[model samples]
Target: MKLTTSALTPDRWSGEVLALGVFAGDDVPSGLSWPRGADAPLRDAVARLLAHGSFSGARDELVAGPGLPGRCERLVLFGLGRAQQVTPHTARRAGAAVARTLTSGPNRRVAVALPSWRVPGPDGGGPGGPGLDLVEHLAEGLSLAVHCGRWNVLPDRFRADYGSDLPQEPESVELLGAADTGRMLSRAEAFTHAVVLARELVAAPANLITPQRLAEEAVGLATPGSRLSVEVWDEAECRKQRLTGFCAAAAGGADPARLIRLHYRPAAPVGPPVAVIGLGLTYDDRGVLRSGGAVQGAKKFMAGAGAVLGAATALAAVGGRSEVQLLIPAVAKAAGPGALRVGDLVTTASGATVELNHEDAHGRLMLADALHLAARLGAHRTVGVSALGLPVAAALGPKAAGLWSTDDGLAADLTAAGYQAGELLWRLPLVDEYDDELLAPFANLRAAGPPSGDGATAAAFLRRFAPPGAWAHLEITEPAWSPRIDGYYNAGATGYGTGTLARWLCTR
Candidate 1:
């Protein structure tokens, strides 16, 4: 969908649908600023419609009615909750609600008039009124919702199974009161493309997206003349670099492992380069082969790698002063002849030996080498995103990802970034007590701990490879791939970490 901003007032806008957002207890048409005599008739019509309909301006509430005689074909009023509590997230949800309500209809053009929010400045006090940030987020939600279901069907699916009717995506979306200074639209487009790319990569079937394919995708991100540059490390390079853990985890698959490194060097440097490592198990069937459990959604095991690539794409598109490096140890953890057996001891590049007690705990093995490489490469800080453990999902539920960080400053920054990006992150303690669970009989560490305290133990295991007080880990499971439609996300890959990483990199 094409998204643009306009200075046109809601009443003067000629479109198939006009969406007006009002905060709770301020449902009157005059709550929104309008020209002197422009919206009188539209206000009267809305007032009559409000009187007859039970359209309280509660959160997510929406009501529609016929438009004025010769103006828009439909007038949509959506609730924005409370004025004081309005935020970028609120704007995003409101945008999604409007898009979902109109996209399934015959409307081809739509206008959205949401209230402006007075966001607090960095120091917590300043005249930071509604501007590019709000407009960008609003556009992100609308575009995401419109394209959420576009890749639900596979290429080889039968035409009958794909269905003939699809939602009618709008041709154009106009932010009724905002201005297009060019940056707003570009930034929003960048974010939308990033999230959509991440979602598509994660949603693809395992047969279509292998480890080699993932490396190719990373290479594709670094187009000619782009700020990003990519390098792929094959098995020989991995062996030369002593990436034993990465190679061992990838040994089971017929396709060789690829260590994808995407570097983004800005025009001017800000701070030291920060490295983001993502676990890239393209297909995980360890549960099915080891414990006889179903592996229906194992393809989503690569969500973290998808997020990493997506963030790289966005950061490259929206140039920033911060130099960033994205690392993905792409592999597939399928059961085969060369798969790591129980009691197998693997020495990582960090010189730490790990006992493979649990064959399914291979993601951490791949990440161990990547984290060590990041630290060895002089990264100021390192952050790893992965679908690590079930205990984390059980603790944090589906709405949030579990966070464990060695540094308080890094943790706070990441938490703030996640909140701003509409991704919830719950910080968990890096309890040193759980370190004992990772001790191996012969090796320096064990792959998995006992069933209890597994989440903390998993984080503790990874901390060994990274530098002290310079690393953070996000253990994401269900949030990466939603089982049902939630907010603007459809029932598939949610592209959880892309926005968080992008926001963090840009702000840093």
Candidate 2:
């Protein structure tokens, strides 16, 4: 949908209907007073009347009554209890509630007088006053509510029977404030587009999203003026470079091996650039090397690769940023004559040696080369976003992701932004204690090893490839795909980090 804002004027701005936001106890500002227009449609106040309406605020309705204004068919009064506790998230819910409620009726447009937020800086007003850019915040809220449904997948029968009956179709928002409504809407649109792209990229079948396909996808990101350079290295190049660590890990996959790299440059050169590395294991059948034959088990490994592709799409869509170099080690883990086995040693691009500890722990091995490549590319702060393990989900639950980063500031920023975007992460320590688990007598790092709830071990393995003092960000596996029905997100790749990375770049 579209969103725009206008001055709270009654003269040139009188419309058929206008929706205003009010806190539980705040007075209606007189600036929005109307002068009884000739063909005014109605005036409405949306209020949270249900006792526990906060959680399911949108599930409530717009109660039309007699206590209204001239030609005022309805009033929408939203609840903001203990106003001091209201945050951006609250604003989002309030916006979603209003939008969802309005869409059910004949209202085609809405003018929201966003509730003012406390300003932390002098850019606008004062603290606890009409502060934080409500326009942007509201737009983000609307975008989330609208696009959250696209990732959701329901039983075909259930959807075919009742999908059209659902009321939560996407909503378009219009800003009624002085802030740059056009730009805010455009950014929101881009964010939504990025989310859609990530979801689609992840939702693709594993066979369709193989290593070569991933490289082709990266090349597609190198459009004119995008400032991105893309390249793909085949198995031959990997073999010569002794990427045994990565190749050994990919030995069981049926797809051809590929190392996909993307380079992004900003118009105005900044300080040392940041690099994002992802584990692009297109498909992992757990290898016939192991006896278990589960199609879903493959998704566990594919999720990591999907995370990388999603991150790339988001980075590409959010174009204006500092220089970035991304390396994705794309390969499938399939059993074959050439597939490396356990106890084998491999050397990384950084010249570090690793032992094939376990064939399934392939994400870390591929990241070895990616991390080395990032360091060689002069990455000041390196961040790797991956679906590393299920232990992360066990630890952080479905809502929040587990994060391990070397840079405290970056970690804090990422965690805070994740919370804001609703797809959040909790800061995890890369304990120096676990550093020895990655070591092997002969290899730089080993592939086969013990499995523990400590998903950060993957990040610990990747640290071997990082240059000293380089910050690293690792997202232990948080199943981006939901096996069951979620309110807005269906049973597919949720595009979990797309918003997080996009917000990081925008604010950075």
Candidate 3:
């Protein structure tokens, strides 16, 4: 969107709705040191709402206020609790809250004002407020807030402006703070576009975004002028390479499996060669079980794929120098006689026999093959993304992802990246003991097992496929999407791991 800056004023502003930021320690000063309390309109407004007392900003706390008769067409006053604690993430969250609250209303245009955050300097230099970085975060939030649906253009969502069902949201966002915000606007727009691309991938429906179509997308991304080179291993190629684990998971589906790889070779590759493998399950029906409840978000089974793609696109856009191998083992889990059943045995490319005890756990199976492929290709560092365990979501809550890593350096690198991207990650253990749970009596490893440390068990299974100390597994169950809006997210198919991986790679 067209992003700019504006200073909050009681008169002569552009927008149907205006959002003013109120800080927790904010108050209308009686001592007229600033330009208020004597004859200012802002002071009058504050005096009118003195009894409400809810506008005191505490972190993660918000309070709404009504617009004045002449001041605001519609105004929302949000909290920026304890100025000292405010970060880019919390600021983005505030922006998200405004977007969620406004989209439901008839208001077509909205603007969010950023409150000056207290950045205390060392050696008694006094607390300084926000600058360009703050504006970037605000714009990032507005961009993410408007993201709600998939790749399709639905005619049913027509707006009155176009006299059609589809109308772009938050037509404009003026990050009302500083005057010269040109650099901030540029940074925010680029960041927002990358994140939204990932969101669209996650939101795409399973029927439309099948394995074949996903492969086509990777091919499409590899344009003549682009630095990325795309390759697809069709069913035959997968068989030739002995990717049996991936094939076993795709046996029942009418749509065949694809081992899609996007290699990004910069002119001068820098840092360690990194490989990111994502689970691209078009529709996860879970073997022969046909219960409706079983496949609720099976379409979103491709969340990890979206994240890796998003990261790749972002890195490309920024001209990053990392030699990255992006891989997605795409498949659809269909329930039928031909599908992989319990007690079936398959051998992977690494010469490890896999026992299919729990036939529905295709994420670990496909990721196993992809990780082995990355290692075989000589990836110095490897990262895998998937929403493998529902129990991880339960154990870790729906706020942060559960991370299991074989290396401290990789874990720390990814964790710092998540922080930079405003995504949260909690490091969970890939316990040595959990490795025993995956061992199969009849084969090298059982495909699936019980619920005790199931998240770790899944990671442990994939760890076998990758070289030690070079791999990190992110069980990204929480950041996928929920039914309603949460912090920095509007609803439906959040582009979670996209930012983390992208930021991590770029910074490295």
Q: Estimate the overall C-alpha local distance difference test score of candidate 2.
A: 0.59
lDDT of each: 0.78, 0.59, 0.70
> Number of clashing pairs, model 3?
7
Error of 1 at 114 (Å): 2.3
Over 428-476, each residue of candidate 3 has an lDDT whose tens digit, in order, gives 8777788788888889998765866667777778888985447887877
lDDT of candidate model 1 versus the reference: 0.78
If scored against the real structure, what TM-score would every candidate get? Answer: 0.92, 0.78, 0.85
Error of 1 at 87 (Å): 2.7
Best by TM-score: 1
Q: Which ten residues in a row have the lowest lDDT in candidate 3?
A: 28-37
lDDT tens digits by residue: candidate 2, 1-508: 5566665532234333354555544433321222223123322222222222332212222222222344233345444333444555555555555554443444444455534433332333356655444455556555555554444321211123334333344343345544545665666666656655566555665777778877887788688877788878898888876676676666756888898878777788677787777676666666322326634445444554555555555556556468877778887766777677666667666777767666556677787777777777788887777765536666677767777777788788777666555576787778877777766777656653358824656767766677556575657345476665343344556667766776776566
Model 1: CA > 4 A from native:
29-38, 117-133, 152-167, 287-296
In model 2, where do residues sit more than 4 Å from their true spots? 8-83, 93-111, 117-131, 148-162, 165-172, 240-242, 287-297, 300-321, 483-491
Worst 10 residues of 2 by lDDT: 152-161
Q: Candidate 3, which segments miss by more than 4 Å at Cα?
A: 6-15, 28-39, 46-53, 60-72, 101-111, 115-132, 149-168, 179-184, 287-295
